[model samples]
Target chain A: MDYLVTHSPALIVALPLLAAFAIPLISRLGPRVRAVLCLAVLGLVAALVAILAVDVHAVGIRLYTFGATAPEMALPGGYMVPVRIMFEVDGMSIFMGIVITTVAVASLIYSLQFLNGQTGQARFYSLMMLLYVGMMGLAFTGDMFNMFVFLEIASIAGTGLAAYRTNMADAVEGGFKYIVISAVSALMVLLAIGILYAQYNVLSIAALAHYMQYTTLDMMALGLLAGAFVMKLAGVPLHMWAPDTYTVAPAGTTPMILAASYTSMYALYRITFTLYGGHIDTAAIGWIVIIVGVLSMFVGVMMAVHQTDIKRMMAYHAISQGGYMLLGVGVGLAVIADPVALANYGRDAMNGGIFHIINHVFYKAMLFMTAEAIFFRVGTRDTNKMGGLARNMKWTAIFYAIGALAISGIPPFNGFASKLLIYQTVLSFNPVLSVIAMFVSLVTLASFAKVFYSAFTGPEMPGYKEVREVPKSMLIGMGILAACIILFGIFPGLIVDTIVAPATEALINQAPYINAVMGAAP
Target chain B: MSALSYEAYAVWVPIVWVAALVVIGVIVLAWRNRGQKSYKKGTAQTDIFLSGIKVPPEEQRHVKAENVYWGFFEALKGFYSVLMRPHTGVVNDYILWFVALVAVAILILVLGA
Candidate 1:
């Protein structure tokens, strides 16, 4: 047990990658066997994450170096340079861990049923595991180049999964667009890493931070990294591929793909808070982030309100919701230089942003699953072709209702918990941004209301009269996220104290992050 | 239950809101249950009344998804036109937007420094 807790970080990433490779061979045993194997791997990964989270909470940051004589030896033989690839399990990384594992478990279970009759089932599961590995590595890796490598892995695997349904031309086009966007963004990330490597002579993030001088080159790298990650996260203007890709992604994988987007978001936060901490112009960068967020919030909803395709509309909403996170964190970044302002509301804004990450993942993933559920039964993604599905798919309708309400920030749901935090804190920072966020939330509710009435309520369509509730496995999948939504909502304080606070602290204060790898700065 | 807040700015105890909602829901349900229960099922009393206009078929009476916000769309047509201009769905245009943002970001960073 002690060994497992100590080495869980490396194991969590390695297990999924190995399982992804071994699954195809294991599938020859039988479909059921393959399914069991997939679940076992994902279950173990989830358990590892839970264990890691507990350990991280109990004992500050947990470091595991890959090639060191000792797992915790970031710098071997007292060398001034730390060259080994290391896994730094900090609060923020573990927070993302919780999210990735939760979504992975639900998505794997959901896929088991959703892809029952499809070919390439083994390949799909393999790619899913690979995506999981990519996200995990991206979260935990302390190396810049390794982060880029993991980013590419996720992008490739995600593109493959996005284009899984090659039978449709739109699916192919969507996949093409996704890869194109991913390729451009990823290249920028790689270039930025190269620029940083050229200057710092090391790829370890902590070591680089300790050596950071915030030179012109460093700011250039920051620009490239920030742009790449923001684009990857689907912040507006660069979000065009999101709707096309999400609308056609096979069921169950869409949520995992969404998690990948949030992983990009995690990368963005890392760059600004950890990588560039206290070096750059906080207000300038913060306002830049805020403007991007504001545009996304308004433009995303504007596009969503007119979308007739259910998944397409939800995709736009995803962009809009992302804006809330950026706004919260942006406010924190803006005020970090002012200790007085930081205490008054900046801390809360960061807390809200971090907390909303998990809440948004749970409810938004479930909402995507519900949209896919609708597509599964009625064989249409167009809302004009769906109505009164509530009568037949009662469980699905209930799940959808829970997700919609939670996402719209309706009282007592998880979205409300996080949005309330963002709202009040952001209000203290600036009233206009708060009002814009509130307006975005209202429009979000109206947009979802339209989808609910169109897809679930009203008179029963003759064509869907025979539609029955989705299979039990799919329900269990959504049920996991729904349960999380309710649990997190009812006990927002517990979650914030346990996980969100730690993450917020980890991001805002870079001293701890740097010292964990490179000893206390002189 | 502790509230999810770091300061005295505001408190959001969702459990309290949830309990209140449940209480109000039960009261509303009880009030609704007190209504007259003698109405006949499947009779003319249950038939649709459209103010003397002939009732359309059930399916036809339902509003389609596209028409849900017809008025809102009309009111925001100019704004939407400006918004929709960039969403040309072409791959090159998408890349163009990305490159444009990158340039703007690099400029800002360089200038600010």
Candidate 2:
């Protein structure tokens, strides 16, 4: 029964794709009806995601293979029957599922008025729905090639969303850069997949991991894969695309885009740990990845510190925060290849990395949404031109401040908790790593201080002087994120144990992944 | 038992890695701290590039970042021009980057195979 329910992971993927198509068509019939329909799909998605999260919690492993035959779990004595297209739901998938759906529900509800008031709102909702489809697809996919397809689908849809405000030249430029960079990244992914397919004759990641059997393909696939995902993950040198796109995208779509892409990063983890068998030595590629991560962290924060544009600054900080997440994951990978190291600090590093990702998605999305609200109210994303508007938009200021604190890793905010975990993990491994992570945190704090001072605290400029508070719907969206930010910040353990642990386990435990696809237990 | 070259490059790679990392770390830290911090009381040789560049109390400020990477590009100006690159503001350079990337990938994979 669980298998039947789980295999229907396509529904998680399909609901939004179907909704996206349905939204624009329904909007033509009636605007009010469109709102209700979008909300209904959102509600259904949230409920289903919650149900799946519960299933993952109760059961250690749940496999949902598409197009079912007699469901079989072969024991040690029996050989395997290949039932390919599957969604393996463990703890991590569920946590990400919950976060994605919850944010979708909130963002869509907020966009009701926000989009309704704007022109071509039907198109906006459709793009957003497709965006959700891509993200949910990412969270649930247990394979790599399919991950790229969804990545492409999401990226193209995101480009359209960024360009929705067609009146602005910068917005159009952002969209162009976004599409071009993402296309290149996607090309890299396709080439990498081609390489893997030629070698393995399989598209399923779990099968490939089993087939690896500790061969050259292990390193080859990984080396190829790291570059492919490095572009997607926006690690350092490849991160040039993110700032411009995020800065110029639609106000309502900003958070959703970050949430979607970040989920892809989570998928990268699923590929590395679950599909690749977590068998390769971290020493192979660990240093290169760590250096890139560290550089991104420092560079992101440094550039962010200098930006007068609020959205652009946040974009740089997003790149930096992404570095923190990657740094932890990279460290964990380094040691996971060695049995002795895996037992000690490797698990901690992995824990910190995954934890930071979850914390990051919520806080970062909220931060972006907060930026959006400010944009809607002021008609600009420039922080230097405006000040003292916080007094007028009190709730927004509070929410923005909460996000600012959280992103800076300030105590009791979600960012601080995960960052602390990362720092602790890195410290246990190497003194230098701890210093770098802490330095990133400090840089993050300093950048946000600049944001607060310039954007919210300075004297109210001419245009913003009369700007009023945004719609209640927008506040509700932020309010939900604000609560989660506080909730996760204070009780990092809950998030760690329930969500992070299972996902981490699924990533670390190569046995089931390989065993599922291949007949033998290696 | 595996054909993976884990040992062949081990000794040199580790030393090189350590040296590169130390150098990179110091460089990154220096770049992050590159700005006005009020340190000197100096001479007529103080220019914008000099740390002791004299200015009225308010005239001094951090360098604008829009053109911060100008020097690096200036050094590569002739090469970038040949490639028709950097600030052409044309979308074709981006397309070329993709083409070159894919070409490199194909070459590597054919060899790897």
- Scored by TM-score, the top model is 1
Candidate 1 per-residue lDDT over residues B75-103, each given as its tens digit: 98998899888899999998898888888
Q: Is the docking of candidate 1 incorrect, acceptable, medium or high quality?
A: medium
Clashes of 2: 3
Q: What is the TM-score of each candidate against the true structure?
A: 0.98, 0.81
lDDT, model 2: 0.71
Q: Per-residue alpha-carbon lDDT of model 2 for A1-522, expressed as tens digits?
A: 565365446677788799899887898888889888988888877777777777777765566666555323322234243436666666667767877787777678667767655788888889999988887777776666778887888888899999898999989998898788777777767776777778777776666666665455445555556555666666665666778788998766877777766776777677667766445444644665578789889878766766678888898898999888888888877777677776666776777788887788777777888788888878778765556778688888898899888898876677876776677668877889789878878867877876776667644555566888888888888888889987886566667777777767767676765565564444
Question: Which residue runs of candidate 2 sit more than 4 Å off their true CA positions?
Answer: A1-8, A70-84, A213-221, A519-522, B1-113
Among residues 3 or more apart in sequence or in different chains, the pairs in candidate 2 whose N, CA or C atoms overlap within 3 Å are: A7-A64, A92-A503, A282-A334
Taking candidate 2, what TM-score does its chain B reach relative to the real chain B? Answer: 0.28
